[model samples]
Target chain A: MLHIVNKSPLERPSLDACLRIAGPGTVLLIEDAVYAAARGSAAAPRLAEAMQRLKVCVLLPDAEARAIADRLIDGVTTVDYAGFVDLVAGHPNCQSWL
Target chain B: MTEGIAKKFMFVNRSAPYGTVYALESLEVVLISAAFDQDVSLVFVDDGVWQLKKGQQTKGIETKNFSPTYRALEGYDVEKLYVERESLEARGLDEGDLLVDVTVLSSGELGRLMDEQDVVLSF
Candidate 1:
């Protein structure tokens, strides 16, 4: 399954909840959730840990929209909307963690 | 409806309108997605029930009233709109208060319907 999270970790527990149940699959961060992938942010360490166990990715357009693309933490892959569609096609199902 | 590839897409709306852009933006995606010809269904749960409320006046907030646009969805062939009964009752709203026609379902039924979807997008 692909877990898509679009809320900022600072504002909501969506990211934490998503990480708790997300096992060995892909985690695509979009909208405000991309902040979790930024280096030195509160969610960076948790994201770093998640990266070791899952395929952690951030939507490039969203990250760029928030101007955090240049500050993304290590081990986080970036993809565009086409990649978003591809991820949906590749995964059996998707759970959007709002 | 793509030839031999019509996937079930369920959009879960859990946020209220106006306070955040999620509700309006989700509607935009829903409208654009109609061209994909996929089986699209919308589930209004939690605070999302507010999006369907009638008599919304956005003039005070200086924002465009997007609620009216929802009525045009049926013209785009995007119809399956569902509202969680518990959510509506908890919010003190009833089916009659909604601006658009929708099927009211219990959360359990909504969950089963969600389980059947190939894609679930929440906003």
Candidate 2:
């Protein structure tokens, strides 16, 4: 399963849901969703823990126009748009929580 | 309308066009998807219906009124525009006030459409 998140990183419902359901899958961040992996974001620490436990692969663009992408915890891989699409196509179940 | 082709994509617009970047960004994505020959459908609910209102004046806000862009969508082959009937009534707007032709659907019908899509993108 691949979950695509495009909402602000601080949002709780989507992140909580993702952690509960995502097991050994992938997480692709696009648009504002990339904020979760930023270095100092409040959401990063919790996500990092979930990422480790689930063995989830995280992908986010290096930059966005309005906000700088930072705070990528260990083990989360950054990827580009093509890689994002590939991850989506590869998954049997894809959910976009925007 | 090619029969049996699974090219349908649904876009759910949830915010007003000018208040934030979401609306404009969604429009660009829609155009891109349509360019790929996908069957595109849009659902405007909540404050998103404000994007379709006629006679929008954005001069005081120092930004261009993007209300006109809805009309240009037809040129790009994105013609399946839907508006929640309840949203229009709540906003005191009717089909006459929208600049584009739209199919007004009840909430139940909208849910059915969402289930029928091959792809669902919400913004």
Candidate 3:
């Protein structure tokens, strides 16, 4: 399954919920959720731990839009919308954590 | 409708309108999605139920009232709208209080329906 989270971790529990249920699947951060991928944000440590188990990525456009492209944590891959479409197609199902 | 494949797409609305841009932006995606001719459905749960409440007054907020645009969804061939029964009841809302007609389903049934979708987008 592909877990897509679009809510800010600072404002909502969607990222926490997604991390709890995401097994070996991919977690793609989009919209405001991209903030969680930043280097010194509140979600960085948890995201680092999650990266050890599964692929953790952030939408490149979203990160760039927020001017955090240079601040993304190490090992978090960045993907474009076409890559997002590919991830969706490759996964059996997708759960959007709002 | 297109003569090719159509994937099942479900847009889950879980927030109230106007408070945030999610509800409005989600509606924008739904409207644009009609061009793809996909099998699209919408599910309203949690505060999302408030989006359908009738006589929404945005004058106090100075925002354009977009709730009425929901009634135009059918003309775009996007007609599958579901509201969670438990959510409505929990919020002290009834079917009669909603602005649009919808098929109300139990949370369990809605979960099953969600599992059947190929794509699920939440807002």
Candidate 4:
């Protein structure tokens, strides 16, 4: 199940909701939601845990105006806009969380 | 008029007014669509309700108060503004406290409205 998160860090919900269900999926971060990739955010620990436990492939646009690339913790892969479109085109089960 | 005659494009605003770019971006899309004379409606849910709150002080944030822009929306013939009742109650706000007149709808009603929309975008 692919998860597209477009919400800011403070407004995000518990990662446990997505983590509890184990599956090989991708996570795309866009808009203010890119903050989820930022270091030291409350969402980081759980996201990291999910990546380690589940094969969660996290993707955030590198050229997106938001300067969150340098802030993302390790394990989260950064991609470009084309990569994002390709990722979505490849995945079928997408759940957008805003 | 026939019920549900128009292909409603519902813009769901979910962010606060300042400290984020989503609010302004969403408004621009709405105005552009209005220029094309498309059928559009707006719904403010979650922290998006703050955009309609009265007495906003953007000086400390060094941002302009775009609240007045919402008031001008009526002149553009885009007047279907719906605010979530639960969100308003949660934030301790009511229609009287908003910058513009809005019909407050429950979450369920809001969901139904969403289902009726041919296109939905969240900001």
Top model number, TM-score: 3
CA-based DockQ, model 2: 0.08
Give a tens-digit lDDT track for model 3, residues A6-87: 9889998678756754556799999999999998999999999988877988999999999999999998999999999999
Query: Candidate 3 at residue A52, lDDT?
Result: 89
Backbone clash pairs for candidate 1 read B1-B37
Clashes of each: 1, 5, 0, 1
Model 4, residue pairs in steric clash: A39-A71
Recovered native contacts in candidate 4, as a fraction? Answer: 0.03
Give the TM-scores of the predictions, in the order they appear. Answer: 0.61, 0.56, 0.62, 0.58
What lDDT does the true structure give each of the candidates?
0.87, 0.73, 0.87, 0.72
Candidate 1 yields a Cα-based lDDT of 0.87
Candidate 3 clashes: the total is 0
Locate the minimum summed-lDDT window of 10 residues in model 1 chain B: B106-115
Which pairs of residues have clashing backbones in candidate 2? A37-A71, A38-A70, A38-A71, A39-A70, A39-A71
Error of 2 at B17 (Å): 1.9
Error of 4 at B23 (Å): 0.7
After superposition, candidate 1 runs with Cα above 4 Å error: A1-91
> What DockQ score does model 3 reach against the true complex?
0.20
Q: What are the runs in model 2 whose C-alpha is more than 4 Å off?
A: A1-98, B1-6
